[model samples]
Target: MEPTQWTLTETFQFPAEYGKAVSAQEVKVTAGYTEHQTEDAVRLSGIYHVAANVGFDGEGKEATLDSDAILIDDVDVQDQSGYFEYAVPLLVDLPTSADGQLTATVIDASATATDDGSLAVMWTVEAKLANVEAVAQNVEGELTKTALATDETAKESKQEVAQVTEETTTAAVTPDLESSQVETVTGYVDDNEMLAFINDLEDDVTVTSFRLNDVFVE
Candidate 1:
C-alpha cells in the first residue's frame, strides 16, 4: 500500500550500513540519522513543532514497516522547517548489531494558523539504514607515494666489488599529531570538550547520555 501522507521518493539507509553482530547488552547500537525538510510555503504557513520517530519498522521490512525508535532531535533555525534529525538507539538484548534504514517521517504536525483549509504539510523525509562506515571513515588522514632510486649495478663486475654507491631512499609521512607536543589523547574527549563544542552553537543545546532503568517518567 502506498502512503498517501508522504510518498517515498527515494529509499536509502541512514548511514548506509548495518551491523552483523550484537553488543554486550544483547542489543545492537545501529547508529544513524535523517533529515526531514518541509517544503511548500502553503503547507508550512503556520506550522510549529513536529513530532518525530527514529525507530524501526517490522522485521525484514523497511523502516516504514514496523520499527521502534532511538530518539527525535530538533533542528535549528527551522521555524517553518519540517526538517528534523534523529538517531536510533538499539537497547534490545541480542547477539551482534544491526543496520537498518534511517527512516524519518512527519507523524504529527500541528497547524498554528488561525484558520486552516486542508491542513496540509509538504515535507521531504529522507531515511537511511545498514550504514557501515569504516573505523576510519570519519577519520582524517593523508597519504603520499614514495619512490626509491638505485644506481644501475655494474653489469660486468665479475669480482666482488664493494663499490661505494649512494642509494636514494624515499619516505612519505606527516603529523597526525596535535602539534602541541603535549600528552596525546588516546580516546574520545570528555564531556567537557563536548560541552565546549556545544557552547559554540548559535542556539541552546543540551547533550545527555541516559542509562536504562536509571530514568523514570511519570
Candidate 2:
C-alpha cells in the first residue's frame, strides 16, 4: 500500500510555571499517539513531549524544562470504504483471519515561540496500512523428455536413467498495488483562552525557542 501523508500545525501555550523563556536551545520533541476510527474519520489522540534548555532572563543562565502537550486531530476517510478495518482494526470488528497493520512516521517538524509566550508546532506525517492474505491454488504441470545418443566405441549397450521432481509452494501473499493521498489540517488554540489560562498559573513563564526531537505513530 502507498502511504497517506498529512500536515498539522498547532499553537498552544505551555503551563506558565516554566517562566518566560528569553531563548531556547537544544530543544527536543517526541510524540506518541493512538488512533480510533469514527464513521467518517479517524481520530488521533496523544501527547507530545517537549524538552529544551530555556533561558528565562537576559542573563546567560539556562535551565532544562521537559513538558508534555496534548495532541488531537481527525483525518477524514469517508471516501475510503473498508479503510477503517484495515487501518484501525482495534476500533472496528473484523474476522480473526483479517490481517493488517498501521504505521506512521513524522517526516518534518518545526517549532516557534510566539511573542505572547505560546508555542506553535508544525509537522508532517506519512501513514501506511498493509494487509496480508493467504491464497491456495491447484497447479498442474506435465514434463516430457526425448533424448537420443550414440557412442559406438565407448559403451556396449549401456543406458542410465535418472528421475528428479521439484515443487513450489506459497503460504501468504500481499497484493502488488499502491494508493496515495495527502491531507492538510490546521489547529489553533485561542489566544484569549490561552491568556486566561496562563494568567491563572502561579508563575509567569513562557517558551522562547523550540527544537524538535522525534515524532512517531502507532
Candidate 3:
C-alpha cells in the first residue's frame, strides 16, 4: 500500500497578508457630488484614492503595517465604468507590521495653478473590509468659539438682561438635583454677567485645521 501526500500554502502580501480575515471581501463605493468646477471642466474630472502610510513603530513593536498597503487612487482605478464607482485596496510592501495609518484621500487631480478648482463632493466613502479595518486619524474637525473677546461688553450687557429675566420668572425654579455623580460646572461669574453670551454659538464655530493625524488600522 502507498502513502499519502499533503501540501500547505499561504500567500503573504507585501507589508501585510490578504486573508479571508477582516480584509476587503468586497468594496462597495457610492458616488457623491463634486466640490467645485475648474475653468476647463477637464480639471473638473473627479478622482479619488485609498492609501496607507506604513512606518516602523518604536522598539518592542514587531513592525509597521502602513506601507504594506497602498491607497486606491484614481490613476490605479479601471476605466471599466463611466462614473466613479470604483475601489482599490491599500496593498503596500511594509517591512514591519505593528502600527500604521491608512488614508483614503479623494484627490482632485486638476492641473490648475491655484486651489481654485476644489470639488465639494457629496460622496460617501465606505468600505467592505475584513477584520483588517481602516479608520482615519485626521478629520477636518470643527472649532467651537461661543464667546468673542471683542464682544466682552456685548456679552456683559446680554448677561445682565438674562439675569433680570431669570430673576423675575417663577419658572426659574429648577429641580433640585441630588446624585452621587453631580457635576456642577462652576465658572467664574462676575456678578452673573456671562449668561447673555449663550446666543447661537452653534453658528459661531469653525474648523480651521486637522487636529489629530496619526490614525492606524489593521
Q: Please report the candidate that would top lDDT against the real structure.
A: 2
RMSD of each: 42.1, 51.2, 37.7
Computed on alpha carbons, the lDDT of every model, listed in order, comes to: 0.28, 0.41, 0.28
Which is better, 1 or 3, measured by lDDT? Answer: 3
Candidate 2 has an lDDT of 0.41
Off by over 4 Å in 1: 1-118, 140-218
lDDT of 1: 0.28
Give the alpha carbon lDDT tens digit for every residue of 11-93 in model 3.
11121121111121122222222333234321112333322221111122222333332222222211211112233332222
Q: lDDT by residue for model 2 over 1-218, one digit each (tens)? A: 45677666555333344333343333444555676665554555565454433333323232333344332122112212101000111122112232245555567766565565444566676666543332112111111111122343224333221111111112124332332111111113355667678678676465344555443545
Q: Mind giving the per-residue lDDT tens digits that candidate 1 earns over 1-218?
A: 12223321111122111211011111111222332333421111112232232222112222221132222223222222222332322211111222322333444332211111111222333222323464245332221111111122333342234232212121124443565333345233565697688789776554666888899978
Give the lowest summed-lDDT range of ten residues in model 3: 111-120
- TM-score order of candidates, best first? 2, 3, 1
